[model samples]
Target chain A: MKNKVIGNTDIVSGILDEQNEFTSVYSKGQAWLNELRIAGKNAFSEQGVPKFKDEEWKYTHIAKALGEHYHLPHTYSLPANQDLSNYKLLDANTVTLVYINGIPVPELSDKLISEGVTAAPASDVENSSEFKTFLGSVADISNHNFSACNTAFLNNPCIINVKAGVQSPKTIQIIHLLGTDDNDSMCFPRTLIHTEKGAYVEVVESYYSLPNSNQNFCAAVTEIIEEENSHVDYYKYEDVSDSTILTTNTYFKLQRDSRSESFTFSLNGKLIRNDLDIKLTAENGHAELHGIYLPNGQQHFDNHTLVDHISPHCYSNELYKGVMGGSAHAVFNGKVYVRRDAQKTNAYQSNNNILLSDEAQIDTKPQLEIYADDVKCSHGATTGQLDDDALFYLRARGIGENEARNLLVTAFSGEALNEIPNETLRDVFADKIHRKLSVMSH
Target chain B: MLNIKDLRAGIEGKEILKGLNLSVGEGEVHAIMGPNGSGKSTLANVLAGRDDYEVLGGSVLFEGNDLIEMSPEDRARAGIFLAFQYPVEIPGVSNANFLKTAVNEIRKSQGLEPLDSKDFLILMKEKLALVEMDKQMTSRAVNEGFSGGEKKRNEIFQMAMLQPKLAVLDETDSGLDIDALKIVANGVNALRDGKRSFVVITHYQRLLDYIVPDFVHVLYNGQIVKSGTKELALELEEKGYDWIKNEVAV
Candidate 1:
């Protein structure tokens, strides 16, 4: 397919030229993997970089945000004894995989000691048949430019495999620290998780930048395959500095009777875009997509999600809420599709936003397309400010203006936060939101 | 404790209160009665510093401090409470949490230490019982899903928690059954101390039957046309506000 050249094609050409050098030096000896990389490169070259003319990229201009100068990752190292305490969301007992500039640091990571589960960097498991079968199968690279770009530069991707009937005892944490002080750097971090039949696993992926780091861009991709009767909970937390430009594409493939729940929290960033796609292929599949994004101070955050129900007796529910302040801009586009074969499917989607300042803006659209006659689908979007009567009511009770505003904002946000299943992790996210709201209010 | 001289107020450039005047000493309960659009609620709102009502030309002194100059929150911190005719429903904020924040903020303004959780819960329990409110009500969001009577009772419950110096009931009896009205009046009666004053603004005289007022003022055309004892309430109730309006016209 011929790709249309749009605004700012310099970034696309630069990335294409860089991919040529990247593949030659990092190509694995495996023929299938090399072929996959070549396919990804060709797909990216065809798609080029998403511009404002693209419907999917209308609200988020990726090429313009990337600018013309950026160096793809070559060699990166973390300083010795780096303080990561602020970045760790869970305790030390949980299995944690740390990645710096898209490369895993095995020495600092915990080995998966649980039975029927294997967690390792892709390089360590590249020869395994399971890794070869599932790496590029779940996520669609031909249609999504960022996913294709991520695939083109995929090197040492994280891989986690869980056998059938295995319920992991602890939550798996994947922490990606992307930044450098030398020059503007860009890295593609890839992840693949496959759970066999009747398996249950929880994964939390969080992104952060090194302290005082220079400009950095991170394009990440994560694909999860839930086999029959399996359940998976996926959470992504993005709290990078203002100098970082991050984009993530997360895809989930659920089989018969499989359940998946995913939460994306875009708390802080300069410019961030998230694409979440879920495909319910077999019967009796369930998926819930929930997210909370708080963008302030000239930041731009865009969330685009799609849930496709293909078989019968499937259900998908999505709720994404945002609180925008300063001159921030946010976009939420949620689409749910129920195919002809997806009889008795139930799909519900809602996106609500609160703009704190006059300059803040939110564009929310909830789209539902159902080809099945016997299905229940609903979609709604609301963008509003804080309730004046509620604020006055609080102040009338003697609460100060700032405290009252915070109270109302927190209440508005708690509707989404309460959906988190884990109590401790919910509290952590709530605290982060509260602290960010306090700063935003001031 | 409260004084208003030539208080003129309005909303959206439409004058509602035209040179209204009234005064009440400490420990007194003054009932201000008038028909609709007579600036009865406007007076109540102006006293509580509601920003929607513009105090065009008004001088209100509470404890000898300029009341109009203070913000609504400061007015609240300084011991003024208005029981809204239609209480705002705030979802997701538990009644107990909202009251706790209010109590602490008022205490902070008074230069006193905030009550600890244990003491605050104990206080809440006491106030809940005083207002005849169920203990479960505190766990729910403020005024959310609450019945009309329960909302009024919640207002009195908040009043009990804050224990303000002056309570302004802005048509608190607007929507309530006899049972709920009695419960609310009982709550207000329980809070009455010798030093606390009350401005019970009501269009109906039925509420005065439960808690007798020391003075009854008939407001007409934004001004008090007549002042008398509790008997004036019964007189107005029997004849309605027509006679008072006629007397003012004459």
Candidate 2:
């Protein structure tokens, strides 16, 4: 606290100082979301940016990042007709949702009208009954400053809805492109995904920053709710520029007999913090949380996941793997909580890390708190280097040193990649990982 | 041809291969038999350019090139191959991909073009019969979840695929049963040509039965204490290593 910036001003006052600017940009017609914004603002005032002293933020230090000055909403304009052909997925039939600076690009979006899926801007449904039930329901911003701040500046939000008993024919691709020319600009992109009973959909969220767009900050909040017997697959790929800082919080709520699988791929960023919370509220709910973070060149990645099993017969499994190189730092804290009434809960969590360079550091902790006696919970964490014997074996087979290391590193991420469930997407991720390795090898 | 002269190497400041000497001519299969801790594997590992083994003093010549100066992979590209006693399991890399990459790397170093996938598959099919390797194993991850005997056979299969000029088998017979040993030996014998050589390092003399060696050398305390014909293996088998130790003492 002694080395604080902004003249001892807390994060709330610093952010709320731009309230008039935010209101002019966001508060147009909707009184409900405006009321929610007031709540979020109040919450941020009560709880400022999380400090290292907080148990949840024990490993990730956000004070320094929050202390910096960032231009909030209404300060930047979207670039015209950006070329994204290179970022498009090849040979896949996908519904593309493009967002620039947290605002949906109507000209670039494609519709899935025949599939009974609605991909539209979140602001369109601000007054709808479904939006009232789904928005901000999964994610709680009461004690979270970043989430609260994101809520307070929510504009041009993305909403995806799947009707009951309808199965999406193609994957939904959401591209969050940051094309801000000015440095130190911040954007809060909100996404709400809701599925009715027996509906199935797969969504991919990709984050990218244009060249020379450094010092940009993005705070994203995504809430996904799966009704009874619904299936949801969510994949997040974070590959921003080195000068950007990204804080993302994704929430998942599963009802009875519903299934959900979420995969997060953190490949490149300056500093990234991801908080994933899953709540299984009804019986026989199942959820899987899997992620792979490959950080190099002074980049830092922190992932904190919480799986709360509040209903009986709920199951949750989490596995995260990371490879750090070039003085990179990574942290993984996975917590599983089975409540007292949640009997027959089965929760498993594992985190494995490989420090490619001696200077690279990794701090991983896997914790499980099961208040119910009938639960089966297990957690494990391991940090180590590449296997010497395996490396030598590959080398002796005429593979070069770098090639051998790349082979082993790629192999290390194979298990998590296999959890993607989709064949083409899995290959895309595998290729991305290989390309990242080649870049690092140089 | 391969040659080693007074090769002294150690690990962690403790000398293992002290004043060792060996020479293998082209077309010859030389069996280097030694008891446990006698530096048989050490000699094999040293020739493979394993960095963990510090060579205190040594000089090795492989096809007139200084073997000591080459990296492990360079040595491999220069037609040297070592079948590890404990084959490492590299998860997520298919056995076929590993062999293809290895063969292509060696071919590239030799200024030869790589084999196309079809040609490589045909070659793989032909070589799979040498060790009776299962076709399914080729598609699975390299050596992951392989049985001990199958792992050893996989080693020989890889040797066949790479077609190294000088192959060093480091206790390839350690974990194999009699039947598996015959399969591995048969595979090795089939690969023997007038232009290639092998340094078979084993603790048991029984492996020498199937892949009959042109020469047998008894290694004692890191040195080749005795050199003789194929009959020398039987002599060592019956008399045990103590006889050689006693003879050296005398």
Candidate 3:
């Protein structure tokens, strides 16, 4: 069986044999897993979510990320009184959903219900074929163990939907604050988002780790479906504990005249790998993928983006910038595929990096495969240190050599931070950059 | 106060400044005119501490200290400036921020408090106007995508802000229209003072007409072959460098 059931069977056998009575989706999940396992499907083993053995993952060793078996969050408890002031939405009129350790904390939000926005824990995602199919659809799970593992055991997810033509000027912030007690724990977080025709909204998946040495494994899968004329700007602001490992997979489908954008900023993680897939499935659909990752110390951050042009007259542009210091290593793999019949497709991608230290390393690759003749597609990758003349110029003006170099490095990273639209989120991203620079200096 | 005694330096062991000697004390603009391949650039690079060029033999005394022992940045911190023939391009670093950082670093080396953003802005505005540069240039990355004229203007702009004790303009007027040349000259002129000195090296005498130096020395092969006053530049312009080589060159 080439279907998704066998993978679910392995998942059900590992985490759900004893407690399978809570939801019907869980039962169906096991049933499908049993059927697929019986059929003995193994065609996808060769395509294991792009591995370190693959040229694309040469720098970022996902196998190391996959090797670590994380402890499941055994329990959940919202501190009787925790602070949410720092995470307040930029637009007070916007809705807010708070989740602490994979469970929704409704007490943290009061104005969301009155704003006509629905926010809840996704305990039944397996019931929605669109949701389950979207998770296993784009990602090459066989290549990525965390993605496949996440699909089998996702306990709860955040579900968000924007109705047709109802545009909210404010933003929707999905806050995932990993607690301090569960040091060395992991969780599978699935988020489903849908925008109907002519709908417009912005979603910020903001993560923070309460102070602790916990090696947190957050395998989150986000699926975004945009109807005709719909627009969705999905911003992912990841700030997990520096000692933790994070793997997040996201897929977006853009219909005719629809627009989808995915922007992410990675900070404070032991190892963070993100897979972003955007498919322009209808004529005139557009997608933009932009992100900035500033890694310090021995942290490892990787971003793999795939923009698939499936129809004619579609457009996609991707630019990912990185500033790596200390002995930290960053990896970027951007792939653009212009399908056979996707004529008149416009796709451009570029990855540029600034290595702030001799010890710092970065591996960036841009791949463009176009079968369509009437298409314009281009890609380029560059990595280097600050220019000597610029450094001397600053020094000649009386600036210390190190300070001048730092200023130049910080400025080089500003182009990517500007992509995050929310002011609060932008500030957070900038603050992380500033903090990274400060740490790199020492 | 600068003294170069029998200085000789070169790249890849081919000796350029063979026993070159020069002396300048506070408040002097000395021009060094030369044909191609003279040790004029070698002298400047030795004093400025460019590591790629080797100092085969030299005793460069800055005020009193042995200048040869210092690193290039230390030499700069000690108040030596070399306006490069070809300025480097740095993307993503603003000119204003770069200058402010340089000014503060030099000041700190001299045991002074760092300049605040407000004071730095005030200083940058005035120096930018001196080099005929707009405020926008100050916000742009240093020499990134700048024309030759703008790069030269930025060089002078940096000189004005740093107020170096000794400024070495190494072929600063090589690629400029008359207007940009005049602007660069004005920037240098405005920075001239009793406590400051300049070593203006050029291939043409037109720049000397604008800066009007106190001395003009002709460098040939690897040594200064002729020495004269401001009139010598006019003579070099009218008689041409070949005449000097065939007539008085040593």
The 0-to-1 C-alpha lDDT of every candidate, in the order given, reads 0.89, 0.86, 0.75
Error (Å) of candidate 2 at residue A217 is 1.3
User: Candidates' DockQ values?
Assistant: 0.87, 0.84, 0.44
Q: Tens digits of per-residue lDDT for model 2 on B7-37?
A: 9998989998889888899888999997888
Question: What is the two-chain DockQ of model 2?
Answer: 0.84
Pitting candidate 1 against candidate 3, the one with the higher lDDT is: 1
* Candidate chain B TM-scores, in order: 0.99, 0.98, 0.96
Give model 1's TM-score versus the native structure: 0.97
Candidate scoring better on TM-score of 1 and 3: 1
lDDT of 2 by residue, A95-186 (tens): 88888778887777776565568777865553454587788887788856678878887766788888899998878888888746676778
Residue pairs whose backbone atoms clash in candidate 1: none
Off by over 4 Å in 3: A1-59, A65-68, A78-96, A108-111, A123-145, A179-184, A357-359, A422-424, B12-15, B54-57, B65-78, B104-125, B220-226, B238-250
Report model 3's TM-score to 2 decimal places.
Answer: 0.85
| lDDT per residue (tens digit) for residues A143-243 in model 3 | 55555555555455576766678785667888887744755566666677887789888888877775553666666777888889999999887878776
- Residue A9 error for model 3, in Å? 15
List candidate 2 segments past 4 Å from native.
A1-11, A73-81, A125-130
Residues B71-101, model 3: lDDT tens digits: 6767788888989888888776677767776
If ranked by lDDT, best first, what sequence of candidates would result? 1, 2, 3
Lowest summed lDDT window (length 10), candidate 3 chain A: A35-44
